[model samples]
Target: MAHEKVNRTKFLFKIIFIIIIIITILSFSTEILFIPTSNNITTPITVLPPSFNSSEEKFLTYLPHSGFHNQHDAFINAIMLSYLTNRTLIMPPILTNYYPPWSTFHSLYNALNKSVIAKKYRKEHCYIKNDGNGENIDNFCDNNKYSKYDNFTMLNWDQLFDLSELKKHVKMVDRGYDFSLDNLISDFNVGENDTYLFIEDKRFEFEFFDNDNSTRQIHEDFEKKFLISDLIKIDKKLLHFASLFHINRIVLENQHNIEFRHLIHNTLIINNSKLLNIANGIIKKLGDKGNYIGLHIRIGDGIYIDEAEDNKILIFNELMNYLLESGLLRNSKKFFKYNLKECVSHNLPIIYLATDANDPRKNLYKFYKNIPCVFTLMDFSKDLENFGNIPSDFDEDTNLKSFYVPIVDLLVTAYGNFFIGTPKSTFSMAAVEINNLYHGKNALVALP
Candidate 1:
């Protein structure tokens, strides 16, 4: 009877153990079971406020040139627009962040935010292979590495939509307008409160401002509006009044032994510190023997590499001769004396920030090492960040996001603030303006 009891007890324990295993499997299955089927999938669309198309709501614009610059601009624009509108701007989940700079700049939806079902269709539809023709080419086309859609990876737009962050409240969208005043009307986020334009073109004229109906009221009745421009000819006085906040400024001052007003022809801002270090180092290396003068070369999109580089070198030589013969550097002798002592140790450096830093013409640097010149490399893979216990995903690019280069930050200063930069980048423009505003008539920061 005791042996029989032992067998029964062991059997009962096995039954319980099996039950527990069954329950654990069911729990995981339930998590995967909730994924919705295609028949029931619905695209997430924002419900706009009644004022969205009304003439009374404002249109805030956040424009960018493209690439990582566009990505950064989108985040910044969303933050500023949210602050202005005082409401959340809803976005559609049909856009991809990855595209050509121009294509991404003008995308109409945020594709990454779509539900898994929508993503299935997008992966099928947004392919160059699926260009609407049913020609399903499934062969292993080994020679097609550089084909239009061969290596295109999707952008992670979903990672950006945290409601807690101010910079992501605004949605990524395309402005439907080029010449039509209606394009301005459609871009307004009526219910959320503000409208923003991240501009790429200078197409709007005073005539483009239309006050038609309730649709036109937003542009007409803005409590605050801003027009941020990197264009060289933007009028500073007009922009300040036009913006709830305008980020550009101008200052007039003279310091050292030179009347800086005479030499203050034009300036651009530089915001990236690594870039600045590269530039500063190159200048120090090249122009260590004399006063250094800097020039930026931007070749046309279609130009040959050989021609552009040759032209740039010739131009540099001519400019140097002019500075000496015209007494430009000599008449303002003390200014250059200060520059020489501060910026170089051996030769006068000539820095070139080419769109394609690899232009074979940059080989000029090899020949002119004694005349030292530098180029800025935007890559920061070598720069390590503080990594204690952060998760791998967050730590992947930590050094880049957390690293602040003061040179880039200073670009937000006022115009003519003394420090200057090249015009090709808005980062530089902002630095110039901020420096001028902060210093407020002081000499440019002199490094030891």
Candidate 2:
């Protein structure tokens, strides 16, 4: 009976073990069927950041037509306007007649450098591309090849800024869109024309007898209007007043002139390495020898005007008298006693003359020939040859070198020990500003 019980217990144990194994297999099979696989898994969807607000509340301004210096003035005013109105400035491409239309910023400056500069400034300001849509536009150098547009060529902004970030805020406009300041301000919908516009608004002509009071009132009025308006287009009038206000504020606050100087320098980039090298060489040569007088003679195109010849002669005489009084030049007697000896020993009596005059031996050139040491752009003929032949008169087909020559001359003039420029000449004005900043003095000025 005991043996029978032991066999029965072993059979019961074996039955229990088999039941456990079956349950384990069922559990494993259930898990294998129910667990998620790669094919069945769901992924979280990603979304891009929202685009800039497409409301009419944003203000836009078009830079007016003019030469490089005037265009630059407009640029500065645009910046001030944008800051005041909290608007995104749509900058016009730098325009020149050399290409019979335009030369883009990229054509004149380092693309990579421009990008870096734009990025640096955009953090504090809203600078957008030509497209109204805030899309990042890169490769400004390649994108703006067809610069010719409506009797004007479009130059790339990369000559001034990287513009990639600014491009993001660009509101693209359709061709031949009405860009009038009144229309832009009054229209409910600007459409693609919102991207960029060029207008010839009249200059704001308001004389302020009391600058402080007038500027304060202007600021107050602008702020009040700007806060309520959905769209504020800066007409020439507003721009002029705003520019005056800001400029006065800067002066009143005793701000460093370097701020303006640096801005101009940073924006007006010279990309041509050969041109830049030549300019640097000239500046260095002048510095190495001794103090030099820099003079800008605006006589080339002036000859065509009625009284321009008389004006030129007057300006020339005034400049000479001023130089003598300022001790930059010695009188005939002083020249023999001091200047002549110094010129012979150290090249102290030298004149670095920059002029639009074509003929080397005629016109204003004759006035400068008597100087002990005189140099003009022609002295750098070998270096300029690298740019190919330059035309005597710029036309639709003028070479890039011809367009760039003035910039090179401007750079050399800016580095002179003392600089004098002609009245109302933007080229001279730019040189004076640059010279003042570089030399830490107010030594640059147009003839009074």
Candidate 3:
């Protein structure tokens, strides 16, 4: 009887131990599953959405009113700002108003082959003309070749936010003749309720002897309140406010956000089949003859107003020297059976020149005419006809077609083996960026 009682007590102890272990496992499993749900449920109450409907989200919209490169800059800044704010981004149309002939806005799809915003955000998040209620004014979506954001609503910057509150939060900063980088960094402090920060373009304005000492002093006093040196410096702060409701106008003062720049470049897809075919045709044409050198000669409008001849010669010589030193034209005998001068006269090994000169034959073309293999958009004039009614001369006054010409030129330049572009030209910068991304070549900048 005593041995049986001992055996019974041992069995009871084993059952008790098993029950405790099962309880412990269940408790741990419940925590692992329920903790995340609890956090998600609490998030909405703690963090307010930046829109009228609590469920609807607000986004960053960029109004690009400048030229191609200026618009390109705005696009880059908008992407970074959107990432930092954790909000959807509204892609701006390529503003062609800078050129009088093409005075209408073109969709991002028309300008680029792919929609970077669509790739990154949900269908409802990104707002483009196709995504909103606006009519397709330019017929960019006639073929249904690109992505559409029809569900997204278009809201102007002023319409989305309280301008009075925005003005109060924005500390007007003025940095006269000399832009103080130090003062710009110290002025901005992110507040809990501060949803957005607007940095006026005039804050970083500096020109040659444009303002008086009295005006400069007043600007300096204003800087004491708030200031920002450039877009790069505030990257961290922007990232911090990204999760919250905040809109920031990127300070445009010669700063390159390389990380975001590369992201934008990689995301852009050239969706226009017509442009793609033209670009491919140029590549195939040059592929038959050895590698080609792409040159961007920017000589339109005010470019020639000051030291025109000198600038032209300087750029021309720079391109020639680069070709010679880089051994791109080292085997003259194989490509062209003549001396260097004769080779240039014959246009040997192909030199693809992309210029804005009204008459290529009259301007730099005269210098490169002797070269055995020099080609331009005029060479593929027939191919351009497939798109629509383009100007015979590819002139700036071809209405909507004016925008297409430069974009095609940009793609051709990017596809080349070697590229040399003029300094401070956004068109060249964009071409170079694409070249670097696609061809893995470092494009040379023609120093003047």
What digit string (tens of lDDT, one per residue) describes model 3 on residues 21-99? 9999998876454221112211111122232222333334433443555655555555544443344444434434231
Tens-place lDDT per residue, model 2, 1-448, is: 9999999999999999999999999988865552322221121111111113435234444433445565665555454334334444545455544222122222222332233333333322433334422342442222243222212223434543343332232222211223234444444344453433322122332222211332334332222212112223333212212122122122111122233333334444445566667777766666532267777777666423454476557666876786678766643544433332365465455667787778644776545544445677776766667667543221223344645678878888767776778766778877887677666644332211
Query: In candidate 1, what residue range of length 10 has the lowest lDDT sum?
Result: 237-246
- Superposed Cα deviation of residue 291, candidate 2 (Å): 3.4
Best model number under TM-score? 2
Alpha carbon lDDT of residue 90, candidate 3?
41
Order candidates by lDDT, high to low. 2, 3, 1
Task: Tell me each candidate's TM-score.
Answer: 0.34, 0.52, 0.50
Relative to the true structure, candidate 1 reaches a TM of 0.34
Candidate 2: deviation at residue 187, Å?
Answer: 17
C-alpha lDDT values of all predictions:
0.32, 0.47, 0.46
- Give the Å error, residue 353, model 3: 0.5
Tens-place lDDT digits, model 1, residues 1-448:
9999999999999999999999999987864553322211121112332235434323334322233433433433333333223333332121222233332323422222122223233344445344333333332221242233232223223332233222222223433212122333434523332223333222221111111221322232233223221221232211111111111111111131122211121121233344445334433333421233433343443343446566556645665575567454332233233333343443333332323344424544532332333333232223212122222121232233222232222221122112224333444433433444445533233310
Per-residue error (Å), model 3, residue 384: 0.9
Clash totals for all candidate models: 54, 27, 19
All models, RMSD in angstroms? 17.7, 18.1, 15.8
lDDT of predicted model 1: 0.32
Give the Å error, residue 308, model 1. Answer: 6.9
